[model samples]
Target: MSALGAVQPAEAAGGTRAERGDRESLFRPLSAEDGEQLPAEIESLCMNCFQNGVTRLLLTRIPFFKEIIVSSFSCDSCCWSNTEIQSAGRVQEQGVRYRLAVTSRQDMDRQVVKTDCATATIPELDFEIPPFTQRGVLTTVEGIIDRAIAGLEQDQPIRRATDEGVAQKIEEFIGRLRQLKEAQSPFTLVIDDPSGNSFVENPRAPQRDDALVVTRYRRSPQQAAALGLQGEELEEPAEPAEDLHNEVLQFNTNCPECNAPAHTNMKLVQIPHFKEVIIMATNCESCGHRTNEVKSGGAIEPQGTRITLRITDPSDMTRDVLKSETCSVEIPELEFELGMGALGGKFTTLEGLLKDVRDLVERNPFTLGDSSAPDRTQKLQEFIGKLQEIIEGQRTAHFVMDDPAGNSYLQNVFAPEQDPEMQVQHYERTFQQNEDLGLNDMKTEGYEEETGSR
Candidate 1:
């Protein structure tokens, strides 16, 4: 007999009186032989189940099967009698599939037995198995079915061992599982399986690389509990150490010559192939003598010397001052040409100096004349006149001293306090004119000549 025909007697025998009464209320009763013929109301009830909440059904097609059963119950409340369903084929068509059974509760027993039938089609079985069945009958059924399918596909009977042997195998399996779990790095274990295709044994605990082996087997709750395993927990890496030596050096030293604080602080300046070198300059406020110091660690080494005309002109001169101590200095970028003989002892005499200045002007043509001002010829004329005065002063020194040969000329010409009255008057007039002309336009010409004088 077909599966539906096979279930007919069982359904009739087990159904409660209330169910029978309800059936009678809906339609006429059938003879024992005709019990396979389903009532016309059965399809409407099945349609109601479909419309209400039933998400899946298994339909078995059996020739000459007269009736099938349909019922709805939650998994928790379901019994064998109220769970089975019988239905009669009301409409038949070629290649049309039908639901053999459906349940209101998603997790209910969903197995279908197709007796005396070659094929069956079930539809819409997409609900999760109830949590309660995860450990009980459903688990056993799943294991049995899996083994059976494997055996059939492999065409062999799966072997079984004694309890002691199985226990030893399980212990070995657990050991291997633990090794796998412990072998993974902490970072690798934190990955989440977003696709639901893979399973992680410990979703919260990281796998250790040394003690565990990661495998494709899905871990059970018992196995996880046995290993005391949890999910992935990531650790934050510690911050890197800072270079304290560089920072400490920056705060301690002043310029070696100027005694003014060095702008580079104490951070060691490095030269290629030089070890732990620091270049320091000291400017003496009293004498304007700038000295350079090259040091390794704390030991000073005499590399070279630099002399800056801190008192640019006689206007900056004061009483004679001499250094109490000797020091080495370095004047980088200060260049002089051979055979120049320091023409008037100034930078203009240097051939390379003029070439560099000309190159600079050529490279930056925009600086040759003021682009904002309209009168270029007047500006050029004024600049030339200032240059003429500087040249005349350098040649004769009459502008700065009454007698160039007198030693007092150097001290008196630049004495700020000694010429305070004349300086104050000149400053007032210059300031007023500068304010009127706009300070940005008050250019200083012949600075090289004025400042270069010894």
Candidate 2:
């Protein structure tokens, strides 16, 4: 520090040259520090951070790094020999670090700007690399093509010639192949294209030797001959003869001779008081012989007659007698009345008249007179007594004297006993007779008569 002593005399008069040197040494550059230093690990970490940060900055400015390498080449004396010396000099001048840095920064700025624009318009390049223009790119492409060809040969032959035309031809061929495959085994294989369209194709078609052809069933020649028909001819069946006598026979006749035709005469015959009858007589016109073929009998008897009687209700004088012409009963001293509408005239009958009168009396017993009324009861009793005497006289003539007509009349009178009015009249008459004849007198008379007769 002899040089220090000579130079620092003006400012370091207060300290020795050595002290000043020590103080100055404390303010020296960090690189001059010996023991006061960062650790090697920390230095290495700092260096890495700086380097990575710089790399990130360069990468951020140069967006082309994200894109696939489209081209790469180097200019050298050997490669650009035709260039003049002046251009060479300019290129050499551009090789300086400052120049390179400036040029590289400008390129990075341009790439970042273009990358922003390209990213939005690069949809076609979504899964594809850029077109290669580098020197060795052709060799890479050739290798890729070879690999593709090898894969296709190993798998299956290319059905179509070129990639662009392959899709359309494959589609048409696949359509036909699918039909064939479906006809054979009902199985199908579908292939899908990158554009999300799909088609079915039959790979099995190439393996098959023959195609299938659909056909309709046909009879064999031998079968046709066995069935008594020509192999190629079809015949219609003959119609059957019409039958004239299939229905049921309304009338039957016997032909006198084998060749003689049958004839029948039908007639409508009516018997008095009987239903009309249909008679069919079959005759052989040639032989003049006849026989009864059909005779439809009727339910009505030819000699029978129908008589009806009607008794009107006492309360309804306008009510006519109910008549039934279907019954057979003859009554004497009765009038014949014609019925209205379709009903024919009917003659009165004894049983029908009696039954009707009995029904009428039974239905209206009060019309005869009420036995419970004092005056009417006496009158009814007197009338019933007279009627009893008349009935007894008829019965005496019939049962005791054997008078046939009287017996019949007595039977008719007694038959009315079934009627309620007639029964009450008989009871009242008997009661009155018993009252008129004293029980003792009747007893004495009966005793005297018995004694005299004995």
Per-model C-alpha lDDT, please? 0.27, 0.25
Return the lDDT, model 1, position 302. Answer: 19
Pairs in clash, predicted candidate 2 = none
Q: Write the per-residue lDDT of candidate 2 for residues 143-218, one digit (tens) a residue.
A: 3223223333442334444464665654554444333323332321111111111111111111111211111123
For model 1, the run of ten residues with the poorest summed lDDT: 400-409
Candidate 1 per-residue C-alpha lDDT over 18-98 given as tens digits, one digit per residue, 9 for 90 to 100: 544444333222222234434222221223233322222232221112233433333222321123333422211111111
Any idea how many clashes model 1 has? 39
- Cα-based lDDT at residue 370, candidate 1: 27
Off by over 4 Å in 1: 1-364, 367-385, 388-417, 420-422, 426-454
